[model samples]
Target: VLDRQGLDAFMRQIRSKFESSLIQDEKNERFPGYARRRWGGALKTLLAAIDKV
Candidate 1:
């Protein structure tokens, strides 16, 4: 039980870090624009599929 609790805590920390990175990325205008320009079609297709659901 202790091991499981420790693992859960570790996973939560990792998830928090990942969320922070995503927030940082969203705040970055240049990175987002570049990504959109590079993968505009794919992104749009993905968004459409998501919307359908």
Candidate 2:
């Protein structure tokens, strides 16, 4: 039980970090045009799904 709890906490931390990174990438305008536009919408969708999980 303890191991499972620890793993769950670790997974949550990783998810949080991933969400933060995605947000930062969306805000960064220095990326090439294709990446900037394409990834922004995709990442937002992915983040929403992650939140649901």
Candidate 3:
């Protein structure tokens, strides 16, 4: 778990579109295939920053 590979695996283990659209896109602009760049990047960056902290 010291490297990014472990983190990626962790994400894959828990990630799920079925979790909820609100979680998948916090801003609630889209869901599933409708999600766009800003929403996708926002979620990724949020997770990355949290992992760093």
- Which candidate achieves the best TM-score against the true structure? 2
Off by over 4 Å in 3: 1-35
Cα displacement (angstroms), candidate 3, residue 7, comes to 18
TM-score of 1: 0.41
Of the two candidates 2 and 3, the one with more favorable lDDT, higher being better, is 2
C-alpha lDDT of all candidate models, in order: 0.52, 0.57, 0.53
All candidates' TM-scores? 0.41, 0.42, 0.33
Q: Count the backbone clashes (under 3 Å) in each candidate.
A: 0, 0, 0
Model 3 C-alpha lDDT per residue in residues 1-53, reported as the tens digit of each score: 34677656555543443244446566665454355454455557647855894
How displaced is residue 35 in candidate 2, in Å? 14
Query: TM-score of model 2 relative to the true fold?
Result: 0.42
Give one digit per residue, the lDDT tens place, for model 1 in 1-53: 23555555654654555445555667886675543343444444444544554
Q: What does candidate 2 score in Cα RMSD to the true structure?
A: 7.3
Question: Which has the greatest lDDT?
Answer: 2
* Candidate 3 weakest ten by summed lDDT: 13-22
User: What is the TM-score (0 to 1) of candidate 3?
Assistant: 0.33
What C-alpha lDDT does candidate 1 achieve relative to the native structure? 0.52
